[model samples]
Target: MSETGKDEKKTKKKGKGLLVKAIVGLGLVGSGGGAAFGMMQAGIIGGEHEKEDNEPKLVRKGEEDPYAPASKDKETEGLGEVHGEGGSEYRTSYYSFTEDFTSNLAHSDALIQVSLAASTRRDGRVLLWTKKHELAIRSAILGVLADTPEEDVYALAGKERLQKRLTVAINKVLTEREGFGGIDNVYFKSFIIQ
Candidate 1:
C-alpha cells in the first residue's frame, strides 16, 4: 500500500467521526427543546396559562366569589332556590313568553288576549325548552283560551282553573318537545276578555 493511501484513509475516518458527532449533538438539542416544550404544556415547568379546572369552585355563604360576574349582586344569588321532597336543594327560574296570544272564545262572540310566563324549580333547561318550543306552546295556549267560556274568564275560581289548565298545556308541550316537563306554574301577566 502506498503511504498516500493510508494517510487518506486516516483523514476520512476522522472526518466521518466529526460528522457523526455533529449529527448526534443536533439531535440531542432538538429533542431537549421538544421535551422542554412538553413539560411547559403539562405545567410542570414555566407556563402560566395551562389550567385543568374549567368550572369555578362553589362559593359558600358570606364568602367572597372571585369569579362571579361583575353585574350580578351577591345578595340575589339564592333567590331562585328550592328544596326538594327529599330535602335536596335546587334552583328555580322563569321564562316569559314574549308574544301574547289573542283568540275568539268558544261558543261566544267574545275575544280574549293573554300574556303569560312560566316558572320551574328544576334548572335553566326548562326555560331553554320553553323558548325553543314557544310556537307550539302559543298554539296550545290559544286553543285553551278559545275553548274557555266567557263566564270562566269573569269568575275568580274559573280564572284560576283556566290558569292551571294553561300550565298543564304548557307542560304537555314541553314534555312532547323536550322530553321533560319541569314547569311549576304558568302565570298570567295580562288577561283581557271583550
Candidate 2:
C-alpha cells in the first residue's frame, strides 16, 4: 500500500471508532434516563406522583370533611356544621373563645375588652388545632390587642385592620404549632373600651 493510502485508511478507522464510541455513550445515557422515568412511574423510586400533601385542604360548602372534629355541642350531636347554598364556595367554621380578652391599648392607659371568634375555610383539623392550642393563640391575640393603638379600636377601618392583625397572629400561632395556618378571619363577638 502507498504511504498516503495507508495513512488515509488509518484515519478512516479512527473516525469510525470515534463515531461508535459517541453512539454508545448516547445510548447509555438515553437508557439510563428511560429507566429512571420508568422507576418513578412504577413507584419504585422517586415520589413525584406519590408525594403526599400534608397541608390542610379547603372544604367546599356541604361537602364532607374526613378530618372534621366531632361536634362538641350536645344540641348538634351527630349533626354536622350546616352550610347555606348561596354564599362562598367554601364553608366557614367558627371557633369562639371561651373567655374574653382584656388588655391595655398601646400608648394609652385605656383598657379594651373583646370576645373573639376565629373562622377557617379549611377542614376541621384547623378548628381542632385551635381548640388544642387555645392558650397559645389567646396569648398571641392578646399581644396583638395590647400592641394596637388606642385610636384604632374606635374607627371602623382601624377595627378592620385590627381584625386582620388578630387573624394573622392566630394563624401564626397555629402554623408554628401544626405546620399549617388556616385561620381566614377573626371576628369580634363583643368589643368594649374603658
Best TM-score among the predictions, by candidate number: 2
Runs of candidate 2 with Cα error greater than 4 angstroms are 1-42, 45-50, 73-82
Q: Candidate 2's error at 97, in angstroms?
A: 1.0
lDDT of 1 by residue, 1-194 (tens): 89999999999998999999999998998899799888888888887967654322333333443433234344333223233344314333556677788999889999998888776755445655676677898889999998999989999998999989998999899888777777778788898888
Q: After superposition, how far is residue 84 of candidate 1 from its true place, in Å?
A: 17
> Candidate 2, residues 75-189: lDDT per residue as tens digits?
2222235476788999988777888999999999999999988888888888888888888998999899999999999999999999999999998998999999998888898
Q: Count the clashes in each prediction.
A: 0, 0
- The number of the candidate with the highest lDDT is 2
How many collisions between residues are there in candidate 1? Answer: 0
Q: Against the correct fold, how does model 2 do in TM-score?
A: 0.74
Off by over 4 Å in 1: 1-90
